[model samples]
Target chain A: MTRAFNFSAGPATLPESVLRQAQAEMLEWNGAGASIVEMSHRGPEFMAVAAQAEADLRTLMSIPDDYAVMFLAGGATTQQALLALNFAAPGQTCDYVVNGHWGKTAIKQVGHYVNPHVAASSEAGGFHDIPARSSWQLSPDAAFVHITANETIHGVEFRDTPDVGNVPLFADFSSSIASEPIDVSRYGLIYAGAQKNLGPVGVSVVIVRRDLLERAGQPRADIFNYRSHVARDSMLNTPPTWNWYLAGLMFQWMLAQGGVQEFARRNATKAALVYDAIDTSSGFYRNEVVPAVRSRMNIPFFLPDDTLTARFVSESKAAGLLALKGHKAVGGIRASLYNAMPVEGAQALVAFMRDFQQRNG
Target chain B: MTRAFNFSAGPATLPESVLRQAQAEMLEWNGAGASIVEMSHRGPEFMAVAAQAEADLRTLMSIPDDYAVMFLAGGATTQQALLALNFAAPGQTCDYVVNGHWGKTAIKQVGHYVNPHVAASSEAGGFHDIPARSSWQLSPDAAFVHITANETIHGVEFRDTPDVGNVPLFADFSSSIASEPIDVSRYGLIYAGAQKNLGPVGVSVVIVRRDLLERAGQPRADIFNYRSHVARDSMLNTPPTWNWYLAGLMFQWMLAQGGVQEFARRNATKAALVYDAIDTSSGFYRNEVVPAVRSRMNIPFFLPDDTLTARFVSESKAAGLLALKGHKAVGGIRASLYNAMPVEGAQALVAFMRDFQQRNG
Candidate 1:
């Protein structure tokens, strides 16, 4: 298979090794008589897969003993409202730090369930930078503080995990999970859609402090209630068994590649190469995200001549680097350097950009 | 590769053709140079897949133009609450015809959001029979009338779709969908998990009459509202892309195999073979479900000597037939003959049953 560098953000690229292994075992998993996609979730074949996946993920993240790890359906978008509906008491405020589109969306979802307090926002500057931690007007008794650790569209990331003081810090780690080692003990909850660094779409990994699970509202819809899922070990329903199995494969892949630290190093290198290309382009390319907080997962850059963006995307596709067109919300080009995109792919993109700039210039 | 006859209730068997096709395309789908699972849901490649899948499903079911078919995350379990929350007005009654476990669970979930009227129930008889339409105590002005067309665990099926008259009849077609030709226009809504006769788990297909979409509640958590999903073409969130793709394959497979009519015939033949084995066993093996409404998909039977169930399950596995153990809710053996399970598989099971009974009777 002549594979290209796939850069589309979440339902994003996965380890080629994982995909190869999935292909090899698609019809019969581990000498079992049925495919992973076709195995009963309750049976030993799949239950062991689900259990191993959860355990591997816990070890990769160094998840604390008090945390409950769940592989849930409904992506980060669902988790946004679930967090507010479950965490906030009646009339309590849900605090949000909105640096990008996903954060704004989370606030809107939360506002439907509870009044969301926008503690800090970078929307005024077209979300070109992550807001300073000191600029955050945090509520002293806020029910929980929410943040999108890596903004996919805006290409901004938290340089350091913020200190939310006493408020439970809940994070949408969708774009950056497993790209770095996170201090799981500090957050009340961390959810990441698997499509981005983990595996495929539809499955999300949620790590919630066990005690905080009690704070979730009782009257919420049964499936929406995390407690229902936690109670059943995330098999509250059939679950995306194939996705869960693929995730287990990905967890093993990460472990084989020397865990999260190695992934973090590779991710940093890929991000730097693409960023360097944009920086040395002599004003031809510009990425507005503050260099200090530039995202290592998604990097969005612009051509000085906006009309050149279309040609660049078309030409990039021809050159075998896929899905570089930026989101309409943040127009230009976005090269998402998730864990699966090697530094070599980034170097190829940089080479393409240099050639394109010279010819267009 | 030695494949087995898998009788798992769900996440069950799949066509070898589909599995082979999926394996071939796992690394690079349709020359796109990326796994279909890795493609962006919004991209042309994936969107084309989504559109084709919807079109194929619509054709297979003969779904009318007025219905909005959506691919949604969370399984049938989530649909339980979503049906009540999306269709019923606040404080209005919803009527349910409960024939088995899933139906009972739906009623319980609906009761949390709206008062559900138990219009009919066969639970009084241990769910061995479907409640008769004549004995139903349906509320006249119920927002909707709900039924489980086929109960997987109980192995009971509605011989024909009920005429609920003015009330919108919403059917959970989870186990029975695509098993036969049905009048899609007769029901207000039909939703099914893509596990049994469709595809793998994680995604469900909801076919709601377009007019009913407006009946959704005003203050719903955005993701919970059907309207939110309808507006976005079920891209309300990332959606279960892998499940959707697999369902597309299943839809194609169904279409190629002469669609629902052909499937129904094969299913009838398969169910008859298994039932014939039990019926001819002379008090050794028994099925409690009233034969008139016996399921074409799930066939639950009892052995006179209950202690032999484990031996039957184990010996069946050894003989290359798998997962014949019945649900814990009702103990014995259940052979789920979904569309993917060939008639030959059932014939093999029947032959095995005859041999086992002769040796041990």
Candidate 2:
């Protein structure tokens, strides 16, 4: 059966081809007679899968050789606490730039482990844009500078990597990791939850500079220790094997799509098609995020009147445009066009939006 | 394709029927036209799946309504830390009974959050037997008592639940959660990683008494807070959706197989078949664990002459008996007969053992 376009913020859509391959191999992987999920992590079969995933991801992102890729659990939210626990000692502070919901969540989670200094925040402007880097207050002895590259809830994204001078720059790129090209050398660490662009919801990928790995501070439990994960090659414990396997398939699928450059061009086209409908609708539909900082992945928009919101969602569902309901915190419609969303799906959504606007306006 | 009879300790074999069903619904679940993996956790579709899973597990285990069944991440190892961080404050102590590798790992992890008291241990006995309850050194102010019901590595199991009087009891039921009937009312918490009797490796089942929910000390990070998980129904963060979904299927499969009573009978027959071979081998094969506390899930044993150990593994693999290699810590063979392992699989192992004994004895 053909799959529907799922615009869920997470546990999101995956490429049908990847799912097909995974399903075909769900019982016997590579004629090994055992599913990849059933294989031991330390075994050569799974080690090859893990290594290949890292290699492909590195190539796609142009990851520096100085960085170590770690597949971890606990999502990016756990990374929020981990970042502080690893870098910021009790007495030390870290710089956190708050742009939207994810950034704010990072700040709150980090505060539990260390004193987090809010360097710059776009909350004053309702998190519709990234705070200017020039407005950030840098701490000379700060452990690191943190940011969320894309806010799925607010449909805001950072078009450029922040220049944090000497302090290591860390990003929670959960919603934006593979969406476009990135300069791996610009950051000390970059992590993303796999639900959106990667594969499943269990694994989180963390890329850390080799030098910064040693600064992961005092030893913690095996699960929480970044150094332990890196040292053991992310097999310190039984990993989410099936999730990792699915992610490996996703990496292969991404590669088959002509890698990152091709993905960026396709994503841009999909985003523009939807944005064009919202823009041309005049007073009928309006996007909340600033045009310059608008996300190419998630497009959150509003109807001219609040009364049409429920109708829009209900109608969209009937039209098979699912999960277009905006985040509760941001009341509007949100269309998340992640990597798996085909151009036709986006076109269908754009056409539906145009028709709805014409009939309502 | 038929999957192999995988004997991995954890991240072990899944029920072939469950894998078939999952593969059938990979792209479209029910009539949703979206995979369960891709569905939004909060959406009615997945909420129904999650709720049904919890309901099925509760029924299968006869879990009380007052208990909160949580689908969590990071496996049983994470639960050790969570149990410590939630139940015991920094200066307080919790009692831990150590029998084998899992128990020792739990003790070490609990040390990260609380000073765990070694109330009883079988390490002095080479971890081949469960310590008698009478020999335990209990602490009056202990927050709780933790035990591993079945030690997957050493093939030691607590045949009976320990009585902790008024203090709550917690069991890491990772290897034997659904293998037999459990007295849910006797314990405050029962946690299991899905790899063994459950489903996969990424998701863990944490059933906690409702009253113990607030014992989660303080608000930690979202991932570590048991209260946050209970409050959000394990959707506090995007859960390991696919793993949880597969676990739900496993729970349903358990119910279909006549629940724990039927499982207990099947598991007993399987274990007895293997153990009977070892017992009658006459100095050829030796299982060290006392019969009273021998595990029905994992059967760890050794050849009288250790020189044949490599040959055993090599010859077993040639017969398609894979992953029979014991853990490094225990230099012998271990066959983990989790709930998914067919009785035929165990019989095959026993047959192989008997044939080998006849040839070498």
Candidate 3:
């Protein structure tokens, strides 16, 4: 079967090896007499699968012992709401450093639960770059300072972690997680929907400092309580077992490929190839985001006109490349170079860009 | 590939054909160039897949136009909490009928969000039978009357929907949905985790009357709002796309097998085979639940003592029966006969039971 190079933002591409492995075990997993998807999460078989995934992730990310990790259901948005429910007192102020669409969404999710203070935002600049750390209006008694590690739609990313003094830092690392190495201890909590760099949709990973579980944040249902999830080892209820199993397969693949350090080098090379193609297009293509903070994981670019943009999307699919359409909020073309997107895929796209530009320019 | 007759509770057995189809399409889906799991939710390919799944489910369940259905991430517990957050005002009274483990857990999830009054409970009698509807003490001003349609652990199921007067009836149909046909208009809302009767572990189906979305129950995030999810067509955020697709496959399979009426007949025959074995065992085996309300889906029975229970579990596994061990709360044996479990599987289990009793009695 022919598989194309898919560049959809989240719920993005996965490693072919992982998919093959899943197919091989779809009916009966390793003599357990049922597919991993069909087994009980609390059963010894799935429990071992879940535990190995967490242990491998901890090793890959170098997570500190003071932190607890959980694999939960739903996307990153659910966690955005829970951040307020599990950390802040009712109507307590929480600092938000807005970079782009996801940052704004994070704030929108908790408006009723917390007084969200926009400490700094790049929205005025059309989200082309990160706001300067010095310009942030820090809250003295804020529950936590929130940031988007990468914005999938706006194509912006944080180049470095900003020091917010004594307040804990919370970041949405959905798109760029595992693309490179970062200090896990720098943030009080890091959460990501597993559809992007991780394996599949329906499950999210939350890494948090153990002490934060004692915050006594606000009155809410037990399902929304992060501490309860941690206590139960993310089996607070029937977890997304198939998704969790798929993600665990991803962790194994990542470690076997030399961990994040190897991925970081490859990511830099792939991003540079596509950016170089855009730079040399001589007005045929333009990427609006500022160079300094342009996201390595997702790059949104534009053709000279909408006519050419439509042609590019249709032609790209014909050329065995898929999902290059931009977000509806910002129409054009977007290429996501998540961990699963091979370097050769990026190279192929760059070659196609030059050929298309030569014909149309 | 000697597949066993798997009898695990929720996250239980699946139709073998469904697993084979999924395996065939793991690498590429319907010539879409990428696996369905690897595509964006907003893309046209998945949009069609999602739409078809919903339509098939509606047909299979005979859902009416006044009901809005959603396929969401997470299991029934998440919806248990959201029921309070989206439909009831903070501290508004909600009447609950508790019969078993799941019924009590549902209450535990919503304790902080609503005033959960236990209107009737069979827990005092070890959940051996469903509480009599005539004896219920429902609240006059309750936001809703909640009931567990079937208790998976205790093997107690409601033979008919209770008429709870003017108050809207909300039922957790996680274990027994689609096992039989019922009038959709009888309940204000019905939610089920897809693991048991539906399909897989990660996705849940929520069928709610349209008027309920207008309630401004309490302050909550945009993601937590039912109105917003419905407006976006359960696409307010990235849904568990793979789980949704799998459940869709299940719908197609059920339709091909002549829908719920056929399943109901098969289920009755299967339940009779097992229960008859228990009843005729002359005290070697025992099922304490009232026969009239005993679940056709799950049959939880006890051996004469602890040693026999452990021996029966081990011997059953060796005889190609899997996951017969009971839940920790109530230790014995449980044989879950979901829609996916074939009639032959039930017959095999009965034959094994008769042989086991002869050897151990």
Candidate 4:
């Protein structure tokens, strides 16, 4: 089994080059005489690696000086809980624009610490579309307006950033981050688990407005405080060094491939290829997401029945097109076209889809 | 340079065979068609990897069926915070037996959630000794008695588990876990960051008595709840898949090498070699730790002055001994003799020390 076009939707496909470099350095990184995994987070060897990663990320994302970046361990779900603990006062109103499964999850994580008001939701419509910006009923005293920029499970995305007046805007950009360019200064905070668009699992990247760190949101341990992590340069404790290092490799690869603008163009091309197949499949396939707001990163579509969906998954795996199974929350098929998915991989998937439709339709 | 003997603590050293296996499998793991890092945590391949790791660890440690094992992120400090949040009520008393820097750090993480009473501390003695068990002022109504089983920085270890009446005993075994055989049933909870003796940096092993999961500790998010993680088999969210996978390989390697009992004998030999060098140095070099409690894991020793110590570090690195620099918290030279550090590595280090002393003295 050679490397396949993996569309597993995070811990998804990584650039093969990144994997190769990591493999080459697995025994001893550079001249350090130890794998990056075995070195201290504070040691000079890893410190340089950590710094280069941060600098590269900042360059790749065009992150501003005022925003502090953190490479943390517990992924976005943990960050979801920490958002309320670090930025919101106890029981403070937090306006959550629930567009899909991840947005709902974001709200669930904060229920104990905040007054999470559902400003708008697409769940009433089975999470197939993003709620209109005009339909939201936000709290005036909300600590932050939270949104999932791209919902991996629902395959719904906010094509445009919604303006939320005075309150800071926060977003979970797990699936869509770095797939394209974004105005980083517009959001108070943006967090993403590295597995999807970035590099690997176990580490997450958190970008936050530095002034927000002064907020004494709630009583919490120092380990839970974002300020402490940022102050320590994300070496608050022994960081997930290997994960961070792998992610660094990813950042460098992304930068070498001409950064977010280049990825945006590639992602647009890839999304079009797959969506074209689904649209032209007529009765054989259907995607419920509105064309205007369908996620370029994750495209969830359904076949006629459960039997065909299972067949598509197994057949795709056999055909070297992998992880086309949709999230269990919405059973069908989901093809995630994250940053690393080459344009050729999308073309191959579309070809597979057409051949499958001809045989099964 | 080729791989050297890496000895800096936590994210310290790994078995060469484990590194070789990981290096071989980094591109694609076990015909899974993707790197383990690039697979979903809930996918069959990673789920099997995660399960086998847990089973192997249970076999290695002789953990009882009554105890639940969890592989988590955020390392030991986060576990330190979660320990208080999961086991003790808000403002409830928790006894902390502080022996070294890490013990003090454990107490620091829980101050917001618990009334942490320092029942005993060896800080006044420059953390050169573990506090006497008989001298500890045990709390009558404490939720749990906490201890650092081995202090990585101070080079002190609790050679015996203290008998705490009624209260559950919890230990941070971050540096010394799986280095020797132990009675898992005696401790209510034992946690270790995998960077040390286990395998990698991101994932942590948590062994907890099952009955403790029923305790309603405090108000916290679902992400912070251990019972939720236990229910999901540590898949409450996307775990660090690569880290978890690498750890599984380490468990297999450890088991094949005759488990903890074999490593215990190896660790004793390695610790003895270094300690003998420091002990016989005739005032030129010294280890201040009390002999009975001197950590067989990390041995921190000092030279007569700063210049010789600096020279030793640079010369050692050039001599193919890497990361010989001591922790910034306690300066001088420190050698960590983890389960993975072969007896030959220790022998080489002692040889270097003798050669350097002959020239420097």
Point out the worst 10-residue segment of candidate 3 chain B by lDDT.
Answer: B1-10
Report the poorest 10 consecutive residues by lDDT, candidate 2 chain A: A216-225
Docking class of 4: high
Q: Write down the TM-score of model 1's second chain.
A: 0.98
lDDT of 1: 0.89
Model 3: pairs clashing at backbone N, Cα or C within 3 Å: none
- Can you write out model 1's per-residue Cα lDDT over B208-307, one digit (the tens) per residue? 9999988855356788889889899999789898889989998999999999999999999999899999988997899998989999999999887677
* Of candidates 4 and 2, the better by TM-score: 4
Error of 1 at A195 (Å): 0.3
Minimal lDDT window, size 10, model 2 chain B: B214-223
User: Which candidate do you rate higher for DockQ, 1 or 4?
Assistant: 4
Candidate number achieving the greatest DockQ relative to the actual structure: 3
Runs of candidate 4 with Cα error greater than 4 angstroms are none
TM-score of chain B of 4: 0.99
Expressed as tens digits, the lDDT of each residue in A133-209 for candidate 2 is: 88899898999999888899999999999889999999989988888888888999999999998867799999999
Q: TM-scores for all candidates? A: 0.99, 0.98, 0.99, 0.99
> TM-score for the first chain of model 2?
0.97
lDDT of 1 by residue, A244-287 (tens): 88898989989999899999899989988999999989989999
Alpha carbon lDDT of each predicted model: 0.89, 0.85, 0.93, 0.93
- Per-model TM-score of chain B: 0.98, 0.97, 0.99, 0.99
Q: What is the DockQ of each candidate?
A: 0.78, 0.65, 0.88, 0.84
Q: What fraction of native interface contacts is shared by candidate 4?
A: 0.86
Clashes of each: 0, 0, 0, 0
